[model samples]
Target: MSALILTSVLGVVLLYLGLSGNKSILAPTAIVGLVAAGVMSWTGWNPGLMEFPTMLKFDQMSTLFNCAMIAVTVLLFLFGIDYYRRMEENVAEHYALMVFSLTGALILTSYTNLLMLFLGIEILSIPLYILAGGKKRSYRSSEASFKYFLLGSFATAFFLMGIALIYGVTASFDLAVIGQKVQAAPNNVLFLLGAFFVSIALSFKVGAVPFHFWSPDVYEGAPTLVTAFMATVVKTAAFAGFYRFLQMTAMPPALSDTLLVITILTLFLGNVVAMRQSQFKRLMAYSSIAHTGFLLMAVLANSAMSWSTLFYYTFTYALATVGLFIVLTLAKRAANGNEAIVIFRGLFRANPWLALVTMLLLLSLAGIPLTAGFVAKYQVFMLAIGAGFIKTAVFAVFMALVGIYYYVLVIREAFTPAEETPVLVVSPINWLVVSACGVAVVAFALWPVLVG
Candidate 1:
C-alpha cells in the first residue's frame, strides 16, 4: 500500500516539476522515487496481508513482479534521458504519465477485487492513450491513439460486463468470494459466460491473435519510447492480472478449450505474418504478439511454478526488448526515420560492439540456445508437455522455428555489408543500456536460479 501511494505521489510530484519549469531534474526525481517505491514493495514482501478491505494482497509474487516492473521502468527512464533530449516541451509530463501508468501496473500485480482490477486497467491504459498520440503532429499517431481508445473501450466494456455477471452470481466483487461461488457451482452457464468474456478482454489486452489487429499499426505509429513501454511494462501488467484472475477462478473446461484455440492461432498468426513485414517496428509488434502466445501457454499450464516461470520469462523478455528498441531508435534515426529492415545492413561494419549486442538481444528473442529466451521458451514447452498438451507444444515449436527465421533474417542484415555508410548517432547512455541488457540476458541464462 505504501509503495502504491508512493508511486502515485511520485507522479504528482513529476507533474508539479513540469509545471514549475524545472525540467532537468524530472527524470532523476522520477528514478529516485521509483527506486524508493521498489524498496517499499520489498519491505512488504511475504507479508500475506490485505489492504483496503481486501482489495489488494501483498504477497511474495506481487512484490517480485513490482520490483521487476520498477527495474524495467528505471532502465526505460535512463534511455528516455537520451530519447527525449531534443524535445523541449512537455518533457516532465511524459515522465509523469509513465509514472502514473506504472502506479497502475503496481496495482495490477496486487489487486484482489474485481473493482480494483477494472481500476488498474483504466489507470494503466488511459495514460497510454495520450502517450500514443504524443507525436501530435503525425497523422499516424492520431490514428493510432483513436483506434486504441475505441478498441480498448470495447474491451473494457466486455470486462465490466463479465464482472457484473460474476457479481450477480457470486453476490460479491471480491476474488475469494467469487472463487468460492465458482467452485460451488462450477457448471453454471452464467459463470462460464462471465469467464469467457473476461478471457476475451484479457486476450485483447495481451494482443493475442484475432484481437491483435490493433497492435502493429499502433506500435508503428506511436513514438518508439511509448511503444517500448506498451510492449514491456504494460504487457507485463496485463499478464499479471490475467494470471491472477485465472488462478482465482476454477476454469471451466470450455474456457480452457477456448484458450487453447486462441493460443494456437496467436502463435501461428504472429509468427507467420511477421515473416513478411518490411517495417522494423511492425515486425517487432508482431514479435511482441508472438511472445504473448508463449506467455499464454504458461497460463494454460497453470502449474505451481507458473508465476515464477512467468516472472523470469517476462523479465528477460523485457530486457531484450528494451535494448532492441533502443537500437532500433538509433537505426531509425540513421536511416532518416525510414524504419526499414535494410537500414540494419552493415551495422557490424559501422560499430561491431553495438552490432554484437543487438545480435545477442535478437538471438535471445529468437530463443537460441544458451540465452535467456531459450530458457524461457524451454520452460514453457516443458510445462505445456507436462500438462499433457503435447500436440500444442509441438505446434508451438514449429511456430518458434518460424520466429527464428525472421529474427535470423534481421541478424543477417546486420552482418551484411551496406551499399553506403549508415550514419548512426550513438549516445553513451544508450550503448550502456544495450550492453547491460545483452549481458543480463546471457547471465540469467547461465544462472536461471538467480532470477527465481
Candidate 2:
C-alpha cells in the first residue's frame, strides 16, 4: 500500500519536472522512484492482513508481480533515456504518464475488491490512451488513440455492468463474499452471465482473440517505447488481476466452457494471423496476442504453480520484448523510418553482437530449448494437462509450433545479406539494456529460481 502511495507521489513529481521543461532528468528520476517502490513492495509482504478492510492486500504472489513489473518499467525507462532523447516535446509527460500507468498496475496486483478492480483498470488505461497518441503528427497515432478510447470505454461499461450484477446478486463487492456466494455458481444464471461479461473485458485488456483488433494497429501507430509498455507492463497487470479474479470465484460450467472456446480461438488465430504480417511492429502486436493465448491457458489451469509460472513467463517476455524494441528503434532509424522486417537485413554484417543478441531474444520468445520462453511454455502445458485438459494442451502445443515460424522469419532477415547496408548506431545505454535482457533470459532459463 505504501508502494502505491510512493508511485502516485512519483507521478506528480514527474509532472512537476515536466513543467520545468528540463527533459534531461525525467527518465532518471522515474527510474529511481520505481526502484524504491519495488524495494518497498518486496519488503511489505503480509498474507494474513487484508489492507484497507479488504480493498487491498499484500501477499507473496502480489509482491512478486509488483517487483517484476517495477523491474520491467525500470528497463523501459532506461531505454526511454535514448528513445526519447531526440524528441523535443512532451518528453516528460511520456515518462510521467507511464509512471502513472504503472501506479495503476501496482493497484491491480493488490486489489481484493471489485470496486478497486474497476478503479485499477481505469487508472491504468486512461494514461495509455493519451500515450498512444503521443505522436501527434502521425495520423495513424491519432487513429490508434481514438480507436483504443472508443473500444476501451465500451469494455469498461460491460465491466461496470458485470460488477453491478454481481453486487445485486451477492450484496457485496468483496472477493471473499463473492467466493462464498459463487460456490453454487453452476446454478446461478445471473452470476454466470456476470462472470462472462467480466471475462470479455479482461480478455480485451490482454489482447485475446475476438478482442485483439486494437493491438496491431496501436502498436504500429504508437512510438516503440509506448508499444513496449503496452506489451509488457499493461499485460502483466491485467493477468495478475484476472488471476486474482479466478482465484476468488468458483467456475460454473457455462463460464468455463465459454472461456475454453476463447482460449482455443486465441491460440489458433493469434498464431495463424502473425505469419502474414510484414511490418515488424504489427508482427510484434500479433505475436503478443499469441503469447496471450498461452497465458490464458495457464490462467485456466489455475494450478498451485500458476502465480510462479506467470511471474517467470511474463518477466522473461518483458526482457525479450524491451530488447527487441530497442533493436527496432536502431534499425528503423537506419532504414529512414521504414518498419518492414527487411530493414533487419544485413544486421549481422553491421553489428554481429547486436544481431546475436537479437537472435537470443527472438529465440526466447519462440520458446526454443534452454531459453526462458521454453520453460514458461513447458510449465503451462504441464499445468493444462494436469488439470485434465489433454486435448486442449495438444492443440496449444501445435499452436506454439506455428508461433515459432514467424519469429524465425525475423531471425532470417537479420542474418540475410543486403546490397547496401545502413549503419545501425547503438547508444551506450541502449546497448547495456539489450545485453542485460539477452543475458537475463538465458540466466532465468538455466536458473528458473531467478524469478520466485
Candidate 3:
C-alpha cells in the first residue's frame, strides 16, 4: 500500500514539475521516487497482506515484480535522459505518464478484486494511448494511438463483461470468494464462460496469437521508447495479472485446453511471421508474442514453481529487450529512422563494443546457452514436459529454433560489411543503459539467485 501511494504521488509530482517548467529534474525525481517505492515494496515481502477489504494483496511475487518494474523504469529513464534530450516540449508529461502507468503496473501486481483489476488495466492503458501518440506530428503515431484505443476498448469490454458474468454466477467480485465458489461448482457453465472471456481479454493484453494483430502495427508506429515500455513493463504487468487471476481460479480442463490451443498458435505464428520481417521493431513485436507462448506454457503447467519461473523469464526477457531496443534506436537514427534490418549493417565495424553488446542481447533473446534467455526457456520446457505436455514442448522447441533463425540473421547483418558507412551516433547515457542491461543479463544467467 505504501509503495502504491508513493508511486501515485510520484506521478503527480512529475506533473507538477512539468507544469512548473523544471524539465531537467523530472527524470531524476522520478528515478528517486521509483527506487523508494521499490524499497517500500520489499517491506511487505513475507506474510503477504491484503488491503482495502481484499482489493489488493501484496506477496513475495508482487514484491519481486514491483522491484523489477521499478528497475526497468529506472533504466528507461536513464536512457530517456539522452533519448529525449533534443525534445524541447512535453518532456515532463512523458515522464509523468510513464510514472502513472507504473502505478497501474504496481496495482496489477497486487490486485485481489476484479474491480481493482479493471481499474489497473484502464490506468495502465490510458497513459499508453497518449504515449503511443507522443510523436504527434507523425501519422503513424496517430494511427497507432487510434488503433490501440479502439482495440483496447474492445478488450476491456470483454474483461468487464467477464467480471459481470462471474459476479452473476458467484455473487462476489473478490478473487478469494470467486475461487471458493469455483472450487465448489467446478462444472458451472456460466463460470467457465466467464473464465473464457477473461482469458480472451488477457490474451489480447499479452499480444498472443489471433489477438496479436494490433501489436506489430502499433509497435512500428509508436515512438521506439514507448514501444519498449509497452513490450517490457506493460507486458509484464499484464502477465502478472493474468497469473494472479489463474492462480485464484480453479481452472477447469476446458480452460486449460483453450490455453493450450492459444499457446500453440501463438508460438507457431509469432516465430514464423517474424522470419519474413525486415523491420526490426515489427520483428521484435512478433518475438514478444512468441515469448508469450512460452510464458503461457508455464501458466498451463501450474506447478508450485510456476510463478518463480515466470518472474525469472520475464526479468531476463525485459533485460534483453531493453538493451536491444536501445541499440535499435541508435540504428534507426543511423538509417535516418528507416527501422530496417539493413540499419544494423556495418554496426560491428562502426562500434565494436555496441555491436558486441547487441550480440549478447540478441543471443539472449534467441535463448543461446549460458544466457538468461536459455535458462528461462529451459525452465519452461522442463515445466511443460513435467506437466505431461510433451508434444507441446517439442513444438515449442521447434518454434524456438525458428526464432533463432531470425535473431541470427540480424546478428549476421551487424557483422556484414555495409555498402556505405551508416552514421551511428552513441549517447553516453544510452551506452550506459545498454551496458547495464547486457551485464545484468549475463550476470543473472550465471547467478539466478540475484533475482530470487
Model 1 stretches astray by more than 4 angstroms: 45-50, 449-452
RMSD of each: 1.8, 2.0, 2.0
Residue-by-residue lDDT tens digits, candidate 1, 1-452:
88888899999999889888866788889999999998988887324443675799878888999999999999999899999888888898899999999999998988999999999999999999999989989999999999999999999999999998988888999999989888888888888888888888889999998999899999999999999999999999999999999988766788889999999999999999999999989999999999999999999988778888899899999999999999999988888888889999989988899999999999999999989999999999999999889999999999999999999999999999998868788988888999999999999999956756
Q: Which 10-residue window in model 1 sums to the lowest lDDT?
A: 44-53
Candidate 1's displacement at residue 440, Å, is 0.6
Model 2 per-residue lDDT tens digits across residues 65-184: 999999999999999998898899888888889988998898888899999999999999999999999999999999999999999999999998888888888889999989988874
Q: Once superposed on the true structure, which residue ranges of model 2 sit more than 4 Å away at CA?
A: 45-50, 184-186, 449-452
Model 2: lDDT to the true structure: 0.90
Q: What is the lDDT of residue 267 in candidate 2?
A: 94
The TM-scores, one per candidate, come to: 0.97, 0.97, 0.97
- List clashing residue pairs in candidate 2: none
275 Cα displacement, candidate 3 (Å): 0.1
Candidates in order have lDDT scores of 0.91, 0.90, 0.91
lDDT by residue for model 3 (1-452), tens: 88888889898888888888767788889889888888888776322453675888777898999999888998888888878888889998899899999999998988999999999998999999999999999999999999999999999999988988999999999999999989988998998888899999999999998899999999999998899999999999999999989887756899999999999999999999999999999999999999999999998898778888899999899989999999998988888778999899999999999999999999999999889999999999999999999999999999999999999999999999898877788988888899999998899889865657
438 Cα displacement, candidate 2 (Å): 0.5
